[model samples]
Target: MRHSASFLPSRKTRIIIGTLVGLFFAIPFVATTEYTFRDVDGHSTIHWANVFDPAKQAAYRPIWTGLGNSLLLMVVTVAIVLFVLAPTMILVNLRFSKLRRIFEFFALLPISIPAVVLVVGLAPIYLVVGRSMGTGAWTLAFAYGILVMPYAFRPIQAAIDSINMSTLSEAARSLGASWPKTVLRVLAPNLRQGLLYASLISVAVVLGEFTIASLLNRQNLQTALLVVSRQDPYVSVIFSLLALLLCFLLLVVIGRAGNVGSHKKGRRK
Candidate 1:
């Protein structure tokens, strides 16, 4: 008891650590905000106002185009996580447990591989992809799906481990439920938190990705920010701040959704 208590942080220590971490992140955001508002004479809102000005639309067109592409990528990437990766994980966990190690290694291999290295291998494949698909930005989701697999895998695998997937799947099958029904009706509900977390992480990763998109010659939010930054640094910072806020809000909203879902399930039981 005493050993465990010693390992636990004191309230004051926790507060200090939290404050320091908060300041570490807050400092840059605050600095960027100030920089965005700064102009020749003093701080002004002209840059913020100009974002909505019709006359200035041409200047910000790339940002808008990139944002649209990123949103589409986010959706398609999430679908890959949900429809492709999640189902494969379910199959591995329930039916082919022997292959778990191999599946896990491949799922996590991307994390150890640097983005630049992945881009090299992806380039030739993308050449074929571009020829067949005509180089639309949405096709980048295939690469983003691979890039985000490590992050999306852990939460989902944890959720799978926490439950008796074999029993759940077997029971569903015995009840005259088809394979798709068992997966959709029995397995998926239990894995809601993991699915939600994986989708959210995929969205965040796709939005912030620059290296893959840039190397692939596709436009995304980060690439657009780069282009706009060369022309107007302030606008780029403003958009960066907005993107950060968006990711933060997405995290909060998805977290709340999970909490609310669990609460409802608890009450139902």
Candidate 2:
């Protein structure tokens, strides 16, 4: 009746797999570093120092603007996504549990729609939004919210699924807590990790997004990186590596936060 250990890879196999995965990522990073350092004289030297120099930033002003816009977009997108998804997910799970699958399917539709096609479909809406809002990063955030819904939905939904919605709501109602109070106090506190993950993933998506931003004539971080790359390849690469490093650090922080939250929740239980 016992299962065999064959499901798990042997130590030697795991080591080989780990090395291959490491090399798969390390090779590109090493090559990019070397390329960024190589000079016009074909010598691999430190050709680009102070990648984040203020003077360099002044020279590439659009990148700075684009970076600012992308940061704003990330904030707005995360806020909008959490605002809409959290409540909807909680309600669907509590009130209309049978329709959860349908809601999930619709939420995931964004991922299936090609960016070019989505842009084409949204041309009229974009035109109206541009004319009314005067075209800024805020406008781009609206589009980004739709694009990142699925990313937000998955985590928030997972968190909702883990909780006892019926029991919690009943207990809150019995205590004279209004529906809004119940959701805001009882549900929101339990779903903190989900909200955190949704925000993190949405921020990452918005920062790295290129296709829709480019097609919509929006200058975001990715677009800015492309613009800089055309003019100063070395600085662009260095900036890109720095951005990647920042994102990696953000992920590490979010992961640690999740672990801490989980540990605290376990202790409380």
Candidate 3:
């Protein structure tokens, strides 16, 4: 009698499936020849007879600049988050248990808070901060910090959770490694994905954040897209493509985090 193969699919099969799906999606863009048109408000104000009209192609360049701004905003916001929150997260993992739980709960607390409330609550705060800090994207970055929490907290928390931190701390103590050295040296290396992961999520979140940036009167990528859509629906479609690309990158990152080196095993009591 012939034996059945393992029920689980192999990695190559999974990759093939993913590639097919990607190609299926890519076909529509390749097959279609029309360039869609929209008014400044993002609505397809005029369905240009030719979708890829020469004029439409020329106008496409500004959207590229807008996309650049979007990427910049994402990068800056993630930087700020990593700079400010990483040490705080490290401290929580080290010194405090009950407080750590509370801190984490509050970090997640921002998630449950309605988007409207977040925008509403932050609008005034940003207005004041903006006045003191001056105008433009960095102000947007600060607002983004709050908006990023729902997405940003998860990876950092996962990083903290992964380390046999308790064991690491004990080992550090036995070796006479100072607390800072243990945290900075022994613990930080294992957190590579977590470090990069949280920042990457922040990029996607800040890039897409409309409510807070809108309230703050900032010119973030989403707001630019929204404003442009009124006059051109096709432009909106292109923005959709850009947004989708960012989202796909975010997913790839979360997927990558799953493939990191094996967890270090520690000794028992």
* Candidate maximizing lDDT: 1
Per-residue accuracy of model 1 over 99-215 as CA lDDT, tens digit each: 999999999999999999989999999999989998888899999999999999998997898688889988998999999999999999999889989999899999899999998
Clashing pairs in 2: none
The TM-score, computed over Cα atoms with residue i paired to residue i, of candidate 3 is: 0.70
Per-residue lDDT tens digits of candidate 3, residues 32-146? Answer: 3234444456645365542346777555554555567667777777777776777788777777775887887878887788777877777778778868987656666766777
- What are the runs in model 1 whose C-alpha is more than 4 Å off? 1-4, 7-24, 253-269
- Among all windows of 10 consecutive residues in model 2, the one with the lowest summed lDDT is 43-52
Ranking by TM-score: 1, 2, 3
For model 3, the run of ten residues with the poorest summed lDDT:
260-269
Report the CA-based lDDT of candidate 2 relative to the real structure: 0.84
**Which residue pairs come into collision in candidate 1?**
none
| Candidate closer to the true structure by TM-score (higher is better), 1 or 3 | 1
TM-score of each: 0.89, 0.87, 0.70
List candidate 3 stretches off by more than 4 Å: 1-68, 166-183, 259-269
Q: What's the lDDT for all of these models?
A: 0.92, 0.84, 0.71
Best by TM-score: 1
